[model samples]
Target chain A: MTDVRVIEIKKSVFADNNEDAARLRSELKGRGTYLLNLMSSPGSGKTTTLIQLINRIKDKIKVAVMEADIDSDVDAIKIKDATGIESIQLHTGGMCHLDAEMTRQGLDNVSLDGTDLVILENVGNLVCPAEFDTGAVRNAMILSVPEGHDKPLKYPLMFSVCDLVIVNKIDVMPYFDFDLDKCSEYVHMRNPKARIIPICAKTGEGVDAVADWLLEEVYNWKH
Target chain B: MHELGIVFYIIRDVKQAAQENGVEHVNAVVMNIGEVSTIVPEYLTDCWRWAADKEEMLKGCELKINIIPAVTTCGDCGREYETVKYGKTCPHCNSANTWLLKGNEVEIKEIEV
Candidate 1:
């Protein structure tokens, strides 16, 4: 006789990831470490902006960058060459996204002792990265002006989950049809509490504002 | 793109659940996917077909996805509306003080043995 049964299990597929993220958050809180998950599209200038932000705030805070990619140490190399701060490269082994577990492992590999801020430059993809919480204190994303202003409607979830949205490459705003006001409106429509800043990473414009916000957030998290 | 990884996770969870319940084989697994989630259902199933077939317990098993509608609630006016339609602002009240009530879930809802 064959046995057949239907079991009703209401478990979140993200349950394990969420639990891991929560635990990571708690541990970081106890250690007074602020982790920021940075996400964006492939050509969003995340790396450049990160370098600028590090230059602005490295003097005030102990910062480390975890550069994640499908396969590359180029970002880690670049950050080390530019800022000389501790940087680690994470290869996802062909995975398009990094989850909480992976992020925790990366945290372990890096020397985070006495580290005030750990910035995870997540694999450049607006989709998969936003779906997983990497136990960061907050989530931020970079939206380059070349990516067009119609992104919010198409990728609402990414915009919805972010705490900060930086519009990069603003120096070329006159060249592109990217309307700052319209883009801000769209982002606000998706996330009312999200802070939107316009900047050009190439010229180092508005990078201080981003650093200021990061410092404030780190302070708030610690205190 | 990461659907294969998600499929692996689903298999791991299902296998664990089956072991806990002392089930011999899992016939199908059901997932609650949110409307705004990054997962694409078709790709998920496609990946499942490729990966699940390799596991003895999940061979020929079906993967079912239940999409949950994204909804947001207006704090000022206390009105609920479709998130995809109205986004952050409430269409009825035009309030920026709004939040997503549901629809960002990726969960295993059921297991058939």
Candidate 2:
């Protein structure tokens, strides 16, 4: 005798996560808060830049953070110290990239009822983070002066998907021979529509421009 | 190293496909991989051996990757060619104005049950 058992499993690898991200996107939009998913390699000054940005825009914009870290809460602590704004650290444990599910889980822990912005500091990796969108309306790519200018080509996906390119750590441009023009050219080549902003996260250079851009993005979104 | 993640996705997808087709076990899975995607096929298969070995639905499943040409289309010349040579500049026109046409694909194509 032959027996037949029929089981139905409808799933995409990231379907559940993507659904969660979609819901978060809607929730953030409803709360009148803009979301930015920040991505970069380790030591690319994403955190430092965030601190600098908070110094300038904290009073003007209500900001929150969803920090993705593999192990430590050091970055979350630093962001809180810099801005005094409440941030929820989403610890990935072993995950290299923060998927939509984790970000939504982090959102559940945040009080976004009256926030103006939520910046998700993605795990320090240039590749996978681009593939998995966390439902953030915008993604910012930070390429530090020390990481060289050829990053856009090698990590094209990350740069191509980014709405903004932050050339961080530009204060030390005198010491390192980083080709600002070449970096922007590459960024433009990959994505002609992307905005490239150069800033020094540590020295507070060109931060207001970034804040201005954020204001513009937020204003544009609301209308 | 991230190939492990891709493999898990593959295993998960194949199991679903197999179940939907009412198949007891999946025999093989075929994927269309772009040359420029960060995923390494060899590493993906290597990770698959361990992750899918114990699953009854995925045991002995074969993984196949279809290579997609890494073509970049020049804005000026309007020509496309395989520029898998690593650099972004177009080899034909020597123009950095080209955009990627393919080679960044990462998708499952087919599965045999």
Candidate 3:
């Protein structure tokens, strides 16, 4: 006599990354630090935002930054120069995104015991980062005015996947042909709950709101 | 593409599943890709072509992708609606008050091995 069996199977290709992100998430939460993954294009003012963020939030919060780039540690150096905070450059080599395993390694090198805010700056890419979860408590995206308001429509995944959206370069609105209302409409279309904060990272116009949000997240996470 | 790495993972999991099921070979892989997941189907297929050829059991297994539309429900009215392309706000009402109902998942639901 012979028997035939049917097997039920469910598998995930991102299992490895998921496990890494899960462990990393617990590690951050266990140590009482709010992790934010900041992602944007190459010239989308993420670094500038970091510089301004460091200037405002460093005194109020104990912060550490994990800067990811393709090759250079220039951004990390810039962050260090702006403030005396601990900054580590987490390079992804040639990879377009930062996965949970990479973020785990980055976190492993940092001390988040008394840290309040830890920001992981992902490589400057739109697509891949949206797909890979880095176990951040909040995934924030920076969209500059020059990148155009149509961005939310073009790269729906990047904008829709974010928890917070920083419409950077608002100060440039006067000089550039940017439509704030249209951009907001598109952003809300993709993610209705996404908090849209417009700012001019160049002139520090709306840095306070961002700092306030960061403080709130850290406060809520820690206390 | 991130799909290349994902393909490797799929191959590994399918191999284990086949071994446990006592199946000597895999015939097809059916996947449900989320619309807002930042995965390009073409790129994923291209990666699968190379990755699957590396495995003896999955050498010629057909790859099928079903794109799941990005959809959400309004928190205020509980009205489910299909996402209007890239813009996430509900079409019925211009309210930013929304929550993702489905369409951001990446999973390997079935494997014929």
Candidate 4:
């Protein structure tokens, strides 16, 4: 005779991810490697901003880029071709977002020794990416002017959890009906502690400020 | 979009639990899904149905989702309200000093055998 019984197991789906994230955070902290998880909507100029930032600070700090996408290595190719920096392409196998375990696996695949700053462009998503903590020291998000000012209201959790919010495409601000002040206001309403920086990736405008902020954080993470 | 991946995780965990408890087959898996979570419940079940059937223990197993309402608390007024309605600003006191109290969960609450 076959035995049948009811088993009650109460466990969180994210519990494993959270535990892995904490361990990764401690490991990165001990290694003095600062991980920045950058997120944004598609075509928000994340790659351009990363290229510009890498070009500006490559001489001072050791930088590595991890390009995560559902498929394709196009972003990784662009990063290597544009800046000649050490870059790794992580394919999530059709997953829209990368969790902590996935981040740890990607880190293991790459070389982080003597790497001061490791930037992960997290799947170019505003929703799923924000929901999972990837053991990053800082969560940075970009909101392009073309994406409009009401995005914070529409996607509150994404703006709320980010430590830094960058408003890109300021050079075309005149073309688009994007109000920088209004957008900043909405972001502040959602997360009062989030720092907002306005920049244009194509013109290389206001990128220095971002580099400066990053340098400060990396220095702090090390010391 | 990543619902299929999540289903994989669920299958792995459930299989482990069933093995530990000497369960031959799982009847149902109840998940606690928060209202504001990024996971779409319908997509999750669809993925579960397809993926769960592949495993021997989880074949014909049901996936039940319990949607939890999102709530926000006003820092100034000490009042709780629906997060989906008013967002960060508190409608009671009109204060922006509000924070989410709950409703970001993606957890497995129960497993039936």
Candidate 5:
């Protein structure tokens, strides 16, 4: 029998990705580009909300978008056609989430010149995407009315990591059993500092607050 | 699906380690998966068997998992408890201000050659 040797290598698998995220954040800061990572479940109206917010802030701030999905460029094409801005599609090659390196590659494909903000629509996954940081200046998620208000308790990590939680489909809240007050309370239970904004993306109700929040964030990031 | 991505990361790290140590043909790779890390061991091993075999050096290599139990510490009560059982609340003091002390790790422990 041949002699067997053991090589010790105790290190977190997320360490490299975390380091890369930090480096990418600093680089984006130097370039005066604010990156926002938007995450949610599939069919959470991410595209509609983006279209609403982008139309409000595009003239004031040079905005671009990176839509990440496992396959298809439908989201990218939709955003470009609706908002008429620079938008690119990133296929994760069957991966459920986008890591820092993937976010960097997507940024490279977009022209960052004269661009103040780049919003990355991450893969529609609450679990895997929260585990990997995409080097975004801030992380936000949209929770629709039909998904129920107890999601914060179910997915604590996703709620805790996000800086903002957009409660979309408020128009249908009366039809569904989603309680806005209870939802806010649960969200606070996970993260006290998280800002919750309720809006109906289809009717453009309460969308100005989201636009204002993004504008303020982009301004603060640049200055 | 998530485990497959993690398996790729493990393969990359192992390959780099082998290159640095001037070694070839890793026999087994050991991983420390925490209880609350959201990784299923069976899926991870399945992905490992599929992906690792595709690599020349890691072909026929075994992926061994060591599960670490999750523990949480309460800030109000100043006590530790099982994370999976009590979750974010401290069972001792019934305080919601508890944080995870351990068991969120997804680390590579070692490699046998």
Candidate 6:
């Protein structure tokens, strides 16, 4: 009979990834690159918001975009066509989230020589993506008006982890019965320090605030 | 939802541990999954079965889970309560300043060889 030897290895599954994320953050800091990990559900207008926000801030800052999806280059091509900036597509090969290692690999494909900021459009998943840190300087998420205000209470982890929350498609708020005040309150309940910005990407309303926020973050990262 | 991805992480860690210990095969991998850690044990084990069998060292390796009950501590009244029942708010003082003390773990507790 073979004896079973138990070996204690008490470590969180995310421990190694957290360490990698930290290392990647410091590396990006040294190179004067600010990475923003943007997460949301599918059809949350993440791409549209990015296009609006990117066009607003492109001239002010040297920017790049990395679009990560299960499979497709549509977002990558869209960003490039709209903003004419360096945008790359990263296929997760069926994975629902991007970890630090995957983010590093995507960054390798990007030209970071003079890039000030790299916006990573993460897979449109509110659940899995929140569990993995992608070595970004800050984390942000978009919650469209149609998704309801209760998302924060449901996906607490996602809301808690993000530094900023953008409430998109606010132009249709009147038709959808989406309460901006209640959404703010719920978001604050999940994350006290999270900054909430309401925007209508289609009309370019409230997008300047997001662009200004990014510019300020990039400036802070530099000096 | 991402149990398969987590299974891959577990495999990577277990393989590393096995390599470090000079073990030929791992008999089982014990995990401490918190009640609120958001991982479904059934899905994790199911994914493990599919992914582990592909690895020579972890073939037929059992994945055992130890559920850790989620607890929350209220800052306003200094009371502890079950996280799953009450969530972020404190039941005693009805304070919203409560924080999770434990039960968010998704840890590899040990490996049996």
With a 3 Å backbone cut-off (N, CA, C), the pairs that clash in candidate 1 are: A13-B107, A189-B88
lDDT against the true structure, per candidate, is 0.91, 0.81, 0.83, 0.90, 0.95, 0.96
Instruction: Indicate whether candidate 1 or candidate 3 has the larger DockQ.
Output: 1
lDDT of 2 by residue, B1-113 (tens): 46776676777777767766768887677778888878888888888888888898888877777878788788878888776873567777788787788877777777765
Kindly report which residue stretches of model 4 are placed more than 4 angstroms away from their true locations once superposed: A1-6
Ranking by TM-score: 6, 5, 4, 1, 2, 3
- The local distance difference test score of model 1 is 0.91
B1-94 per-residue lDDT for model 1 (tens digits): 8788788888888999999999878998989999876778899999999999999999999998999999999999999999888777799988
Q: Alpha carbon lDDT of residue A182, candidate 4?
A: 93
Number of the predicted model whose TM-score against the real structure is largest? 6
Residue A199 in model 3: lDDT: 93
DockQ for candidate 5 = 0.86
lDDT of 3 by residue, A1-223 (tens): 4353434565556776778788888878888988999999889999899889888988888999999997989989999888888999987777788888888889888887788888999999888898788999999999998889899888877887898899998887877889989998898877778988999898999888989988888898877
The fraction of correct interface contacts reproduced by each prediction comes to 0.84, 0.12, 0.58, 0.76, 0.84, 0.88
Which residue pairs in model 6 clash with each other? none
Shift of residue A15 alpha carbon in model 5, Å:
0.9
Which stretches of model 6 miss by more than 4 angstroms? none
Candidate 2 structure quality by residue, lDDT tens digits, A52-166: 8877787877889889988888999988987899887888877778777778788788888778888899999988888787889899989998888888977887888998999
Tens-place lDDT per residue, model 5, A1-223, is 8898999999899988999999999999999999999999999999999999999999999999999999999999999999999999999999999999999999999999889999999999989999999999999999999999999999999999999999999999889989999999899978999999999999999999999999999999999
lDDT of 4 at A220: 96
Q: What is the lDDT for B11 in model 4?
A: 89
What DockQ results do all the predictions give, each relative to the true complex? Answer: 0.69, 0.24, 0.45, 0.68, 0.86, 0.91
Stretches > 4 Å off in candidate 1: A1-3, B69-103
lDDT for position B92 in model 4: 93
TM-score of 2: 0.89
Per-prediction TM-score, please? 0.92, 0.89, 0.82, 0.95, 0.98, 0.99
Q: Which stretches of candidate 5 lie over 4 Å from their true place?
A: none
Compute the TM-score of each model's chain A versus the native chain A and list the values: 0.98, 0.90, 0.93, 0.95, 0.98, 0.99
lDDT per residue (tens digit) for residues A171-205 in model 6: 88888889888899989988999999999999999
